[model samples]
Target: MAMGVHGRRGRGGRRAPMAEINVTPLVDVMLVLLIIFMVTAPLLATGVPVDLPQSRAAPLDQQAKPTQVSLDAQGRIFIDDAPVAEAALPQRLADLAAAPAPPEGRRVYLRADRSLDYGRVMRVMGELNRAGLNHVALVSTGEDQP
Candidate 1:
């Protein structure tokens, strides 16, 4: 630093404490933080990682936290993140129906891989319907496919 009166001067020509603040470093740090968040934001979404079909339809007006059913490319089934065998899905869904008031709404979101067999997806839907869970919706990515 230069040994000169760069700040407010006192009567003896000695520089007083700088009352002004330097914001350059503050802005630099803030920009770095922004970039970090921008880089990491997309990585925070956790899910079954199925390639959802693209749709132009409007999003569902969700009334409650729906049950999540997922089907992978290999035809494995999942209920709310728990693996369920194909044969057990119907009975499992029926048991879920016998629960108290909340599960009665039976808002189910069916997420299947885009490459999944259409018949397989239909079979799951059929089971959900048979179990009195008619309020089912197929989950799909928006118009843009990643």
Candidate 2:
């Protein structure tokens, strides 16, 4: 060991040890990553466009994976990718509602094309409602959040 300023041995003649951990740079990097995620999270949720019919009712809070019924532009009805005849809708929904469920009740989501007739949509809703399926939902491309 070499002599230091005060004639005392000085850490094998090396420099003094680091007394504090440098965490400010790490915190800055983490904050930058957090800001990046906060900015991009909302943009990642883009969806298809549709002019949704509006009402004053609050959206339903559901806990189950709701059944999705889609009506195409040509007034064709689909229940989870299988084309469903209009005549068979009542029995189909009844069967689904009556089947064993996991949770959040026997709720259904109905997606009608924007070009479809309101009465047609209403009829589907009515049929499901009348079949004792009280938790039917009209699924649409919600309003653009600008």
Candidate 3:
């Protein structure tokens, strides 16, 4: 009498190694990374906390990394999230302008708290202009954005 096990081996009675790659694990890993980044992306936008004003204007198209100048509700000034004295702001802006710039010039994003005095914000803008950093964009939240 002869007996054979069903679906366990080929005609040669030997198991064949799988040649196909299993992509389920790879897909699972990629999905996990995507979720992690999606959750963390907004938090990384800016280090300083400010109650930005709302505007109906659309967001600007950004081609390069621009310098960030922020003014908080307390009237504190920050350059790229680092605190800067008002007296030193002009010098710092001058130094930034002296650095290598793109053909369109170094772009600066000015973020001021909505509660700040208009004159204070203008003073910072004046400093930026005096330092030859003319390409300034006011950063504001969209009307529908939180």
Candidate 4:
């Protein structure tokens, strides 16, 4: 019975500090951050607010960042979320076209409020075509999405 001063162990001394890392708390924090980002990511995608029409068409595959052109319910125009006067839109579009484009050419995304008249959307499209920005895609929400 070679008992130490504590009377429970042969080596009887202060226990060595644990070297293994506890990962439970780390995992918990990471999962919380991931969920927070997932919740806010969609909100940050576009700045200009518009009531998009719902469509059953599938989303397009994107290779590069496309230029966004948004038309609000009030018939205001915006390029990449920046407000542009209707008279200035053509010049802005032309400048965008003049910029070096990818091999597939520059792409434009048209996001118009569903409340807008069809002619308004077509006129915007027509302006884009005149500016040599023919690679235009109409932006819409999925039918199942809110």
Query: Which is the winner by TM-score between candidate 1 and candidate 3?
Result: 3
- Scored by Cα lDDT, where does model 1 land? 0.85
User: lDDT per residue, candidate 1, 1-146, as tens digits?
Assistant: 57864567799988777779999999999999999999888787653364458778888776677889999989899999999998899999999877764634667889998888889899999998899888888888788745
Task: Give the whole-model CA lDDT for all candidates, comma-separated.
Answer: 0.85, 0.80, 0.90, 0.89
lDDT of 2 by residue, 22-127 (tens): 9999999999999999998888766645347644456677666778888899999998889999999999988987899765566678888878898998998888
- Range of the 10 consecutive residues with the lowest summed lDDT in candidate 2: 48-57
Per-residue lDDT of candidate 4, residues 34-113 (tens digit): 99999999888876664457777877887888999999999999999899999999999999999999988798999999
TM-score of every prediction relative to native? 0.58, 0.55, 0.60, 0.60
Over 33-117, each residue of candidate 3 has an lDDT whose tens digit, in order, gives 9999999998888666655576777777878889999999999999999999999999999999999998767899999988899
From the highest TM-score down, the ranking of the candidates is 4, 3, 1, 2
Worst 10 residues of 1 by lDDT: 43-52
Question: Which runs in model 2 stand beyond 4 Å of their true positions?
Answer: 1-63, 144-146
The reply for model 1, stretches above 4 Å from the true place, is 1-52
lDDT at 123, model 1: 93
